[model samples]
Target chain A: MKVQVLYFAWLRERIGQGREVVETEAATVADLVAELRAREERYDLAFSDMGAIRCAVDQALAPVETPLDGVREVAFFPPMTGG
Target chain B: MSEADFDLGAEAARLEAGEETGAVVTFTGRVRGGGGLRRMVIEHYPGMTERALTEIAGEAARRWPLSGTMIYHRHGSLAPGDRIMMVATASRHREAAFAAASFLMDYLKSRAPFWKKEETDDGADWVAARDADEAALERWNE
Candidate 1:
């Protein structure tokens, strides 16, 4: 499956881009993260601590265990600080 | 999304409030000055941001008897004293309007996909999400 991965805020800064289209066979959000982390040093650094990052699948908040089989978009970023 | 200051008074006047509407509640969030802070920049998830906000507004309406609801939030660079966001809720009674506005705010503070970075005289840094804000969201679920 392919997922449109997005990064926001500091995550975007660290990853050096806002979004990317990834060709992956990962099944879950955590698995997808591992694949991204393995791809480059920046991704590994941005995703070093899953506890500090939040994920959303198809614009809805999702946990690391969330399945990505049918999902088209996934976003990663720090916890929201908006008001 | 607006870089210019919003006319909140004008906004409230344009809000929907028919003869049945007995109350209209509004809340405004502003950036605080001092601490040598120069300005702040907000970033959002674009398409997902609007979707999340609409979902939250729907949740607020479902939770309370609201006649109308409005949420306006700004992105991009903002100086101190700038208005960060606003929420307005109209209902037949005061409690519903107040509660709906509060509910929308709570979600905005946490669930919204917006991030703020503060630039001060020393340098700049990303504003971290507070544990207190996350804790605040729990009250609604409880």
Candidate 2:
């Protein structure tokens, strides 16, 4: 499936890219993350600690086990600090 | 009435308009200057920020018999003493209003997609997440 990935805050800085389009064969969010983490050194560093990153599928907060079927967008960021 | 803006007086007036609401809880978050933070700038993921906040407000409404709710968050450049955001919940009793308002703010602090950049005398850095925020969200665990 084709998915748009977004990184925010420190994740963006570490990865050196704010957003990207990835075509992955993974069926779950965790699977996709694993695939991305293996693609490059920066990806590995950015996603090294899963506990520090939060995921949202199509703008809704999702657990790591959430399925990615039909998901067009997946955003990864550090936990938000908004008011 | 459910709306988000940057005006405090209008929100206070709206909260006081209803006779059924005996309590109004308001929370104003401001930029803290003393906490190793020199200058603060807030950035939001435009559409996503609004969606998350609307969902939070809807959830608060569903959880309480609130007379009204108003959320105001400022975007763009901000410095110390600047108002960052505010949440107001009006209900029939103080307890419900206060609890709901606090719940909403806690949820927003961790769930919403807003980023802050703190410029210190040394350099500019993005704000880091705190463990306290995660603990705050745990209060609403099912």
How is the predicted docking of candidate 2 categorized under the CAPRI scheme?
A: medium
TM-score of chain B of each: 0.96, 0.91
Tell the DockQ for candidate 1. Answer: 0.87
Q: Which 10-residue window in model 1 chain B sums to the lowest lDDT?
A: B9-18
Segments in model 2 whose C-alpha atoms lie over 4 Å from true places? B1-5
Looking at candidate 2 chain A, the ten consecutive residues that score lowest on lDDT are A74-83
TM-score of chain A of each: 0.97, 0.96
Q: What is the C-alpha DockQ of each candidate?
A: 0.87, 0.70
- Measured against the true structure, the TM-scores of the candidates, in listed sequence, are 0.96, 0.88
